[model samples]
Target: MKIALIAHDEKKKDMIQFTTAYSPILKSHQLYATGTTGALISKKTGLPVHKVKSGPLGGDQQIGAKVANNEIDIVIFFKDPLTAQPHEPDISALMRLCDVYLIPLATNMATAEVMVKGLEHGDLSWREIVKEQEGNDI
Candidate 1:
């Protein structure tokens, strides 16, 4: 499975913690993240992560493009609901793409934890079927 990790500045610490806790399960999959978050995750967990630009610098859109291409199966975005984001439109577009692609998305820690565990237990194997079907359409 391909998983994308993203977080607001306020939630970067939480994202780090989540990645660290799930490193064992996560290491087996391809990981992608926005700039700073990807660097921190790689440095702290020693897990290989493909890094894109910072979210405000178009990383969110980059990931959304992959989602639209059916290249990413899961997205874990730690949003800071209370704070205002300068790139709110980009974030909204990313979430919408996840919906459009039927890709699983977790916007908070609680949902992310459940999704990660589900990923470990093969609950998301349906993604492969979706990908296969997408290929057939092309």
Candidate 2:
């Protein structure tokens, strides 16, 4: 599975800790993330990650494109709701793309934990087939 990770400036530390805790499970899959977050995670977890530009500089859109194309199966976006973002529209678009693509997205630590746990348990194995069959049914 391909997973994309993103974290707002204020939530980067949480993202790092989350990635560290789940690095073993995550090591089996391909990982992609925005610049600073990716660097931080890679440094701490030693997990290889494809890094894109910073979020405000089009990183979110890059990840959004992957999600739209079904190239990413999961997205863990740790957003800081208390702080206003300068690139709010990009963030919103990323979340919207995840919904449109039917990809699992976590916008906070609690939800990210659920998603990561599901990943660890292999609960998402049927996602692709289910999405395909649902499309045919429709």
Per-residue accuracy of model 1 over 21-103 as CA lDDT, tens digit each: 99999999999999999999999999999999999999999999999988899999999999999999999999999998899
| TM-score, predicted candidate 2 vs. hidden true structure | 0.92
Angstrom error of the Cα, residue 25, model 1: value is 0.5
Task: Give the Cα lDDT of each candidate.
Answer: 0.97, 0.91
Local accuracy of candidate 2 as per-residue lDDT tens digits, 1-138: 899999999999999999999898999999999999999999999999999999999999999998887788999999998999999999999999988878899988899889878888989998778667867976
After superposition, the stretches of candidate 2 with alpha carbons farther than 4 Å from their true spots are 130-138
Report the lDDT of model 2 for residue 119. 81
Using alpha carbons, what is the TM-score of model 1? Answer: 0.98
For candidate 1, give the lDDT of residue 113: 99
Candidate 1 regions exceeding 4 Å error are none
Clashes of 1: 0
Clashing pairs in 2: none
Cα displacement (angstroms), candidate 2, residue 87, comes to 0.7
Lowest lDDT sum, 10 consecutive residues, model 1, at 129-138
